[model samples]
Target: MLGVTDYGAFVIAFLLLLAIPGPGNFALITATGKGGIKGGLAATCGVILGDQVLMWLAVAGVATLLAAYPAAFHVVQWAGAAYLAWLGLRMLLSKPGGAPRTTRMDSGQYLRQTMMITLLNPKAIMFYMAFFPLFVDPVHHQGMITFAFMAVTVAALTLLYGLVAVLLTHHLAERMRASPKMANLLERLAGACLVGFGIKLAAMR
Candidate 1:
């Protein structure tokens, strides 16, 4: 059985990490702004799929294997960290919301970006790798049972956060579109948050 403290810590850490706007969050917001609630929700589903893949991979010992090989693990971690840093920089530099452009978001783009964003995120991989071991008492519960619990918890959280972001973007789309200054500020804040998270992940033992 998982300890209450472990579960609480996992929830807090996961939610805090997700709260920081990154490529995934920005993508969701942009989709909401462009296509309203329905479109945003659809894109969010793609994100959920990407997360689900990672969750399973973690439970399968992929993260453990990567952790075992120091050189290879460092290579993967650095690459992921660099990718996240690049995303943060890009978000910081991007122009604010503008008039709805003719460029329509397609399913392909949605899936591709969602997968890339989640998979490329070293911080996220590290998080699950670190988090799952805490609550999992494989001696007490089956490995699959623990993994299933964690996966379901994460999926539900994703849905909640995605919907919250979608609603916020939808509610303020027009105002956000008009305020370049606010957009730039949000971009900077989000970028800083990602960079900070990356640093924290990199520093972890």
Candidate 2:
């Protein structure tokens, strides 16, 4: 429907991709853990907005430009990796017994931060560009309708995944509140993972 072929397969593939642990998921879980459900939701919205922007850019053929310019692609990749590493380092080095970082951030800040995180990752743009065409029926393409459907599907799935991550992380946060040490440890671990992701992104060719 909507000029998309194998809708079921598309949904399954998309969900599987989402399920993979990535910087986006890490940000969601970390935000929720630090800022509670409200913070988590704000981050989620930011990510969704970022994804929409990237998808549209892909549709506009930015992906071709990226592929044409290896240097440009590497620039974005390095920037994204650096950004993730910076965030991870901050969390990793944070001293315990202080106010949580989430407490200091308003909704707007969370939104902006997460949006930047999503936008800086060039891999996401590549993924959308590569994956979107596979499901699009060129012969039956209905322009806006097909694009809109795909956009909405991604947004909906992201929302569901974000909500689940927020709930689960919030639960864990609640338990961790009673033990500062454990909370600190978990935060450090999350930070480490973020750093690892940054390193991985940097290593990607």
Candidate 3:
């Protein structure tokens, strides 16, 4: 487990997190619908790479530095809170059914677009910076090795989730169209969760 406590819970938590509706999910669904399996797969690759980048940057920097200057950790917490709250508000205000935005036939285009979105994704970094530490056994932490293991675990989980999402989205494309309300409800719920997380993170201090 590489210093990760409750490894099973970590995996389960991540898998459940993936189940939540979000921009990345929409991008995958849209890519599949517009460009088929190839495009969806390409987008999936993009998401994995983007998440890897975000994960390393946060894990190596924030987690490392924060342990030293614990006070400075508040900055990250505040930033995450503001960012999450903003995103939640935006999602709440957005006309449900709206996605992060996409539609491309070229695999490369889908990859690049999704990668960029994931790179700038608020939820990605917020979760990494704020949520990751919860499971870290600081006393048993193995520095980079621990972070690396977590990163790999995250990447592998994302790949599995993306593959399943692509296949399911492709298969459910028609039914999804028929049940647009379900998508809207998910968005609303996600927005609520984001806001709740933001408040909770802010209060943790």
Best by lDDT: 2
Report the C-alpha displacement of residue 61, candidate 3, in angstroms: 2.7
Q: In candidate 3, what are the lDDT values of residues 1-205, reduced to their tens digit?
A: 6899888998999999888876567667667875778889998999889889888877666456655775666766666666667656665675655653333258998887578656654445656988788888888889888888888998899999999888887787656567666755655566677677668767774
Ranking by lDDT: 2, 3, 1
lDDT of 1 by residue, 1-205 (tens): 3322367777877789789756678667756765678777876887888888877877677777777777777776666667657656765666656432312666556556556667765556656777777766555666576677778888888889999988888898767657777756765666666666556546655
- What is the lDDT, from 0 to 100, of the residue 80 in candidate 3? 63
The TM-score of predicted model 3 comes to: 0.65
- The 10-residue segment with the lowest total lDDT in model 2: 97-106
Model 2 off-target regions past 4 Å? none
Error of 3 at 23 (Å): 0.7
> Per-residue lDDT for 1-205 in model 2, tens only?
9999899999999989888988888888888877889989999999999999999999898888999999999999999999999989988988887765656887777888889889988988888989998999988989989999999999998899888888888988898889988888888888899999999999999
In candidate 2, list every pair of residues with a backbone clash: none
TM-score of model 2 (CA atoms): 0.95
Clashes of each: 0, 0, 0
Better of 1 and 2 by TM-score: 2
Q: Could you tell which candidate, 2 or 3, scores higher by TM-score?
A: 2
Identify the superior model by lDDT, candidate 1 or candidate 3: 3
